[model samples]
Target: MDAFFASVEQLDHPEYRGKPLAVGGNRERGVVAAASYEARKFGVRSAMPSRLAAQKCPNLIFVPPRFDRYKEISRVIRKIFLEFTDLVEPLSLDEAFLDVTNNHFAFPYATQIAKAIRHRIFLETGLTASAGISYNKFLAKVASDLNKPNGQAVIPPEKAEAFLEKLPIEKFFGIGKVTAEKMKALGIHCGRDLKAYSLVFLTRRFGKSGRHYYDIVRGIHESEVKPDRIRKSLGVENTFEKDLLTSSSVAETLTNKILPEFFRRLQQSQTAGRTLTLKIKYNDFTVHTRSRTFPEAIPPGSMEALALELIRQEELSGPVRLLGISLSNLIRPDDPGRQLRFSY
Candidate 1:
């Protein structure tokens, strides 16, 4: 799916086509959920503050997100994926990993399978999707994004090492802003730079994830794509239009705004969990997360009290930019005492 949320908005509202448009955000504190290519040309992007997006593109049109419609279209796309292989691992509603090694049609090449799936998606949903076909998930995910909206890229096994060696550190999956900066400070700018470090040296510098970095840089990712992945946690979050100035305001938003939405989703999913986690992002973009796990499930009515307690436990660090609440260690009705999680 290309610019998924905004694309859906354009598809339903013909007037928005070819215009600078975005989904999510208001003129104030909200963030952009997705931006059209037209908006992207103006340097607008998802997770960007609405005020910043406006500054970047003065004529940017912000449409409220219609998640239900997007999910409906996503279902159509997933069905198309299943036609080729049952080993489809969805990263999000709009992106997935399909292990077409043993596809239903006995296709000899993954690129052929990718093209057929992309064609079917456009035929069925009237939307375009880009694909990356490779021998592993890391290369495949990176390749997919190389070509944007209605394009495909392939990286054969033989080309993986040379391709990775020249790739920038920031472009590698699983490396965040802080890690990228840390690598830069260490004079590591590309995969070749990263590969020069020993496993022991990287682990000492980057904690447990350093080993992951060491391997992925050398083209050593061996993770398999599994089908029917189970979700580990579910949550809702919001960025405030105005900085939350006090604990009372934060508590109010958590109970009045965030909790109701969270519980509604919980009820819809019919899932419960023993752990409740609260995430707070300061105005400076620094984040803090606190969690509480219980032997028994916390009742819905008690959630507000627990959430408030969690908020109070933290120092009123700075005016909060964003607040979120989630439930993890989930137990679904059909899977008792079973917990499954996804790692990206």
Candidate 2:
């Protein structure tokens, strides 16, 4: 999908179409969850601070997120994907990977399957989608971004090496901004530069991920398209308009705000966890985290107490700007040995 959340807003509200629009944020606080192409031209982008986004695009319009509506549309899109291929791996509400090697229509070309899927999505949802057709997930993911809005690109196997050699290191799928900077510092500015290093040298420099860097540059990614991807954790966080000045206020927010929302999501997902983590961001923008693991899933009644304990255990370095709680070491209902025991 193209600028998915913002695009959805444009589809439902004609007034927002073809304008600089953002979904989720305000002029005063919060973060931009998505930015329309119009806003992107003015340097507005998702995850940018709302204040900064406003400065970048004076005419940018901000709208609150409607996740339920997005999910509804996402389900419709997924249904279309399933009609073509059962081997579909969803990365998020707006993106997915479809292995069309043996599609329902038996299409000989993956490019044709991609075109058909995008067309079906636009027809059914009144939204535009882009696609990347390639022989592997890495190249496919990279190719997907080459085209914008309603376009598609393909990277055939024979051309993969030459194509990657010229591609910037920053353009690789798994390389983040921080990693790219680190690579650039070491004269690894492009895929060709990275390919010059030996496997042993890369592994030594990048630790376990060095091997990943080495393989991907050579167009070697063995990861399969997992149709059923298990979620590892569930969390919620809130950035405050004013910094929390005291431990008491932090504890109050945990008891009244954070834990309640976390529990609601956990119940909705019908999953439990044996580890509880506390994440804190200070006014200085530094982060700290603490976690406690139990022998069994933490009961609903014990959640508040455990959350409070986690907060009280640490002293505030300064005024706090954000607070979050998460549950990990998940126990889904279908997992083996799924007995719940009280160990706290």
Provide the global lDDT of candidate 1 against the true structure.
Answer: 0.89
Against the hidden reference, what TM-scores do the models get?
A: 0.91, 0.95
- Residue 128 local lDDT, model 2: 94
Model 2 lDDT per residue over 292-338, tens place: 99988888778788888988897889999889999999887887887
Q: By lDDT, who's the top model here?
A: 2
- Please give the TM-score that candidate 1 achieves against the real structure: 0.91
- Writing each residue's lDDT as its tens digit, candidate 1 over 1-344 gives 78999988999999999999989888766889999999999999998888899999989999999989999999999988998899999999999999999999999988888889988988888889999988889999889889998999998889999999999999999998889999999999999999999999999999999889988887778989978688899899988778898999999999899999998888787767889999999888889999999986666667778999999996788999899999998776777654433111
Residue-pair clashes per candidate, as listed?
A: 0, 0
Q: Stretches of candidate 2 above 4 Å error?
A: 340-344
